[model samples]
Target: MEFSSNIKKLVMLVNVTNSPTESEAAEDAHQAMLNISIPQTLKYSGVRTQSGTDIECSANETILCDLGNPFKSDQKASLIIIFETSGITLFTEQITSQLQLSTISEQTDLLPVPVTLNVKNTVLTMFSLEKQVMDTSFSGSVIGESAMNSTRDVGSPLEFVFRVQVLGEPLGDLGRLVIDFEWPFAVSNGKWLLYLTEIVIRGQSESHCVPPGKIVNYLNLTLSKEGTKRNKREVESVYPHAEASVTVLTTRKVPQFLDCWRQTALCQSFSCPLSNMSTQVEVRVRARLWNSTLLEDYAKALRVEVKGKATLRLLTDKPAIKMENHTREFTVNVDPVLGEEKPYEVPLWIIIVAAVAGILLLGIISLILWKCGFFRRASRREMYEAKSQKAEIKIQPSETERLTEEF
Candidate 1:
């Protein structure tokens, strides 16, 4: 009888019966044997079969071995086992068995996990307004009116804080992280300007791991203005009046980390100079992440991007002046004080009047002096009388002298 069956362990049994006619030690001993060969690729731990080599087996013997999977994910291979029997048979016969082994089970591949980003809070620390006032007549009194008004300057040493959080698998040591700040109305009319002075970034604890000869958790930031574009229509607009340039603020290489594995991140701080503007401003904040080992080229392949927005408003307070139509009259008696109250500016009419009065007083003084003979010249008749009197005196003196001589 011939039989074949599939089992974990193989066992072959052979029975040989000698006829009674073969007495005493006349019959030689009968022996049965088998040969087995297995494929080389099927060799696994705890199995004793050599690939492409024949293994001798005796009848009524069983062989046991374990079949372990050795193939990788999605791989295909074949296992062939061949067996041949010989040595003893009722009739001349040959037996051969072939089996095919294949490994279909595979491992799963690892995929990148998605990350989440969020914006926490936006605070406007400082605000100011620029206004131009025009004087207008109201009730015979001058009142000021706002000609143009806009937001002007923001207080200096200002700070803007941003928070980042990880949502997915832990990102390994990041090579680079970038945060870009863009002001939408930077190019609007009124020549708005925004200046950033300093920037700081903090990373999570797990992200502090640095590879050999490499620094992890570092950030690279840049500040620049958008390329200039001419907009004739915007320049002619009445509200803005002219086209302006956009401001871009970038931070220096600040160390930062996002531990997706641990779901944590650091807060970012930006110190800016006094920023001024005349219109509503929109700021766009963009954040990007890069692998620490790959650097720039691999950044795109394994990068994360998140965006946020903030709006700043300028508040102003101006005094209002008004004049009343009705008035009341009152009488007062005052005691003079030692100190004089002086006007800040003398009137032009008062200056002219004072100059004319001074000239008139000088002329009057000169006329009075002239009438008092202070500047008079001598008369011709008076001069002639004086000369006649002097001559008669001289003649009398001479006559007296002659009489004395005759006596």
Candidate 2:
């Protein structure tokens, strides 16, 4: 009863990139490469496309988006565009110094190798291969690889590549960080189902170094896989989930934003801070699916909406400015047109009850008056009494009214 070579492996990868250091032997690029491994498999893992946002292009990762179906047979995964800028300093130190980065270049393979094993099937969930080079910030996945219905091959060597940027500056109080990741790889086509997850950060470690110290790697390659699929799909399952990565780009900053002046106001108000600065941000949201439910569920991992909301806090010099949550909602349905969610005041049950009570009270008062000659003729005695009451009230109503008149 022991493990065999046929055993598959599951790994979790969190690419730590572009970390700042306080010492001379802080970290280096080559040292960062040694960290990201299967641990059990020892497969060298790193991401090349994650390093330089624009250093190279036409990457090996292929995202086959079929307008409707992202995971078309031709393209098993969707395109995850990554842009991370870093300040890499080739050095080394100790501890989880700067996150170790992989030196091996990326052998871009968009199509996962298909296997026919009875192992659980695998699907593309969080699929993005990019990280900022160093201390600077960009965007990357949070979970290494989160899936719905899938499992790993148990002992498979899954190679991963992520870029690392080293910061020449000193870290103040933050140090020794772990990028928790989940490796989602399968050895069988039957085990593959849908989706992935991960979280990344620009970190500095204290354990990496070479001769003077030790080779500290700035970037890390993580391998991970969960041996389970969430749900199964059929033809008519309500609606298949889908995701469209529509990156919305703009030149406007928050605080000072573009008021809908349309044709006229579009040219009128371009204020300070926002005037000379060109800022960019990513708004990851969920959109409606357009194809098979099986495919839609897979794509929902990436079905984020495209909303345009930049910050104006950068206008002032305040160390770190808090960005006001600028969120938008859009729901795509069976109908061709997409519907956006507006801040709506839905009628609550309490309000409905209050309205009903008011209506009932008004109805009761009307009924009473109608039955009491409100519209019919009044009797002679009743008319005389009414006149007397009015006269008595006019002459001297109450002590309160008399006091008011005296005043």
**Residue 353 in model 1: lDDT:** 97
TM-scores for every predicted model:
0.19, 0.16
Residue 34's C-alpha lDDT in candidate 2?
Answer: 24
| lDDT, candidates in the order shown | 0.26, 0.24
Q: Judged by lDDT, which candidate is best? A: 1
TM-score, cand. 2 vs. native? 0.16
Residue-level lDDT of model 2, residues 124-239, one tens digit each, is 11122232111101011111223212112111111222222212322122121111221111112222111122212222321211112111111122323322221234211322
- Tens digit of per-residue lDDT, candidate 1, span 176-264: 12223222111122221122223333343211112222111122223222212224452223113112233222222322222212222
Write down the worst ten-residue block by lDDT for model 1: 134-143
Model 2, residue 390: what's the lDDT? 82
Number of backbone clashes in candidate 1? 8
Q: Assess the local accuracy of residue 361 in candidate 2 as a C-alpha lDDT between 0 and 100.
A: 100
Model 2 alpha-carbon miss at residue 47, Å? 53
Candidate 1, residue 233: Cα displacement in angstroms equals 29
